[model samples]
Target: MSFTIAIIGRPNVGKSTLFNRLVGQKLALVDDMPGVTRDRREGEAKLHDLSFTIIDTAGLDEGPKGSLTARMQEQTETAIALADALFFVIDARIGLTPADRAFADFARRADKPVLLLANKSEGKHGELGAMESYALGLGDPIQISAEHGEGMGELYDAVSKLVPPTEDEDEEHEETDEERAARPIRVAIVGRPNAGKSTLINHLLGEERLLTSPEAGTTRDSIAVEIEYKGRGFRIFDTAGLRRRSRIEEKLEKLSVADALRAVRFAEVVVLMMDAQNRFEEQDLRIADLIEREGRALVIAVNKWDLMEAQPGQIAGLRRDADHWLPQVAGAPIVAVSGLMGEGIDRLMQAIVQSYAVWNRRVPTAALNRWFEGAIANNPPPAVSGRRLKLNYITQTKARPPSFVLFCSRADAIPQSYLRYLVNSMRETFELPGTPVRITLREKANPFAHKRKRPN
Candidate 1:
């Protein structure tokens, strides 16, 4: 296992900014607002020749037990326990405060090697603040600017002293393209409140890692956990249940919803959980529509199957209803699952794998154009304002929810119904089901207009 480092600090201390710099990507959500990150996020980070895993944690703050902030602090403590080393960051511009001192004591109790980071250390005031941090008695503070990429060499030197690279790793090369491609697939579990989203995640992990209850909104922040299923790695993000916009009056709930939306945008596949008893409710349909609009691979998991009284055609009926209401994602895979009892999980996993494959599928251009020719011949594009529409060719522009562009004459003349027809035909013909398909029409210029026909 790689040496693990946890970056913990009070809110808005540039901890996330430093994490982004180390990982070389903006994987975490960064905002001017404090506590933007409510859950612990892990990433592989490299500094100079040193490679290790780094964890970005929620800002440490004291809160009443059972409150949302309290739960966020629990997440931070969990990261501290898991880390071999800790990066204690403070806002140099603002200088140290009671909270910084309080968290410093907290880190001191952890007994792990801790590195004091005086972030935003780019000015004279910052230097003065770094000098003040020495009074905390942690160690000499490393002055570094996370945003401007200054003082990284000192940061690297400090981290290296704590966790040195192994000799075996020194002889080994960097991760090849194929190894990188095999990284875990990101999946987000999302749905309405009390829809068994967290329960389902617990079942997959085979542990009560996520807090669950019968209450309507047990989950708040989007918590991501890594898992391995059938020799495949997946980083599953369990998101807070979404509710009607008008009903969300609490500021905290709104932030949680925003975080959940971010998880959906970042995920490769999303499992929309639904209560078996109250399946296909208005909120459920709305969430499904949002997922489709985001162009994500989707799997419908009707949870709590054990509670449902057995009916002869219950599964078939559920499938029919899903298809009828959610026509945008027509033919999406629906699996009946009991999160508490762990029934039908294998099939749900299979459906997710299949959906992900379809979302990433690419078709050959020649095959696509051939299918287009046949479909157009059977049901041609309608004439618009006395001019016949001509579709010259169709080609897939990209995949990961299969987008295509059709070069034709008078692109704006093509009706939405025609585009729908093409999308549906393409879906069926290309074996792509339960995935969003985008088709764009482009008008081809008429080159022959400059050479007028000679008067005969």
Candidate 2:
């Protein structure tokens, strides 16, 4: 990114709506309610020819010290400190409130180039409010309706002036497979309410980069941050806690759950956080099942391990329980961690990297067929309805969850239990532990069946 810009404003001023439009994606959750966004979320913004990093911050509001609102304000302040420019957004339809006046001074105190944006500026009401904003001393307000994108041209002109010009660069190079492989591994930390997901990410980042609290579902957005462990780089996401479906009541929480699920789908590896006191609970199993169903690599992190007694064989017990609870992701690595104290952080990271590698693992065709034969020999696909099942062979179709296609005489006749056996066997043979292995049954194409017979 050439320059960083932060969008700061009072609640329900359409800051997030503007952020989604600038980023060309609905990356930020937008709602009519105030303070839908808490943590500062960043995205690459492109306006015509200009490209830069844009941050969406929480609503600027005053609250008691150490409260969630206060922490959110702290997040906004941090974004301001890191930005080269500020977009002071105000509701044009509603006109300036005390918050707009207060935060206008806050933005001015930052001493950066400020662009006063009168959001919701789409009509005569907007024009009146934009005219009212001139008293804030933040210069002429740019009237732009974030929802309808009415004055994007004006927004572009103002933003372009603040960004410094750079010499035309060389042509961009195409990314190679090796370079892609070496890029940061995307990992999402997900789990039930207050399972230390944010705490673990904060420890890895070695800073208070993400908001953490005893309050369940404190994180409303899927916040991603980059970190380097040892020599490898990773993009880790701190997501909102997921509760049982019956328990979700609020509309905002539902949106938060959807955002977290989106993060999981985008990630290469997902770490399922579990409270040590309540490990392998029904909800934890459900989450693990969801991760497996999504076909992402799984790593179980038993959090708050420091509070547990140092009993011998406790690690083995956890392993046994994990396999028993989540057989779909059997052999997945389980690490006991204390995110608050940073214990087992290194091991957790190692497990993540290892699981990612396994998820993308592929076996050569020769080796794969050999394993298929041996697996069939050990426990053949059982007969269904007294008809013998002819298993021809199997080939790996893809990786990144390691999918396969098995050619057989009767595709439908092959029971799911048999496929499960084959998957487990392949995992054991190829050392593909933990990652979800998919085997799709297909009937071998009969060449003559496609063509017309002689005269029959």
Candidate 3:
């Protein structure tokens, strides 16, 4: 296992910025608001020739027991326990506060190697704050501006002294391109606030790995957890619930929403969880539509099934409603899952595997062209402005959502309704249910257009 370090401090001390800097990617959400990050996030980080694991944690605070704030702190504590070292950060621009002093003691009690980071140390005031941080007795503060990429050399030196890389670790086999391609299937779970997304993921992992509470908007970052089911590996991302655009008033929420969207785009399959009681609302439909528009394989989970009164044909009814409300994603898998009780867990995982297969399915050219011929024979292109549109050959361009290209006499004359017809027909013909299918129409170039015709 790689050496792990946890960054912990009072809220808004540039911890996330430092994490992003180390990971070389903007994987975590960062904002001016304190406590924007509620859950702990892990990433593989590299500095110079050194490689290790880094964890970004929620801000340390004194929250009332059993409160959401307390749970956030609990998440931080969990990260601390998991880490081999600590990066105790403070905002150098504003100098140290009582909160920082208090958390300093908390770090000491962990009895692990702690590196004091005075972030935002890019000015005279910052230097003064770094000097003040020495009073905490952690050691000489490393003056670094995580945002500006300053003092990284000093940081590398400090971290090297604490945990030097071993030759065996350096000889460890690096994951190759083929290995990456065959890695775990990426899946993201998303829905409205308090839809039991976290609960479902926890149930899957058989542990309370993610911080969850009854309160809405407890999650503010897209947290990815890797797990296996029936010998297949999957990297599941639990995202912050997406609300209506107008309802997103705070900057932090907006950042969270953006992060969730990035996760959706990054994922190979997305599971949209909804409250079993209030499922299929307008917003739910909107989210489903958004996923289809993004061209990702989707699975709808009606969560909290235990709360609903089980009725005869309820499962069938759920299917009918899913198809009716969101025909764009027609034939998509719908599973009634109680994330709390682990009901329908096997079915959900099966659905995800099936959906991923469908998403990456590619059709043979011969079979595709044969279907095209039959489709045009059944209902040829309609005449527009007294001229019959000549439909030419069709070919499948790619698959991961099964897109195709159609050569026609007049591409501009093709109606969207006609395109929808072709999309539906191809979907039915190819057994591609619940996956987005794209078809592009191109006008065939006339062979004799350039030849000057003799006046007859």
In the range 318-396, model 1's lDDT, one tens digit per residue, is 8899989998998899999999999999999999889998999999978987898899999999999999999999888
Each prediction's total of clashing residue pairs, residues at least 3 apart in sequence or on different chains, is: 0, 0, 0
Query: Quick one: best TM-score, which candidate?
Result: 2
186: Cα error in model 2, Å: 0.4
Sorted by TM-score (best first), the order is 2, 3, 1
Model 1, residue 139: what's the lDDT?
Answer: 93
Q: TM-score of each candidate? A: 0.78, 0.96, 0.94
Location of the lowest summed lDDT over 10 successive residues in candidate 2: 160-169
Q: List candidate 3 segments past 4 Å from native.
A: 163-181
Instruction: Candidate 1: count the clashes.
Output: 0
lDDT of 1: 0.89
Clashing pairs in 2: none
Q: Candidate 2 overall Cα lDDT vs. reference?
A: 0.91
Task: Report the lDDT tens digits of candidate 3 across residue range 1-456.
Answer: 789999999999999999999999998898887888888999999888778899999999887998888988998999999999999999998998999999999999999999999999998999999999998999999999999899999999999986677454546788996796579999999999999999999999998888898889989899999898888899999999899998999888898899999999999899999999999998899999989989999999999999988689999999999989988888899999999999999999999999998898888899988888888899888899999998888888898888888998979998888888888887788778888988888888999999999999
List, residue by residue over 350-387, the lDDT tens digit for candidate 2.
Answer: 99989988999989999998888888888988988999
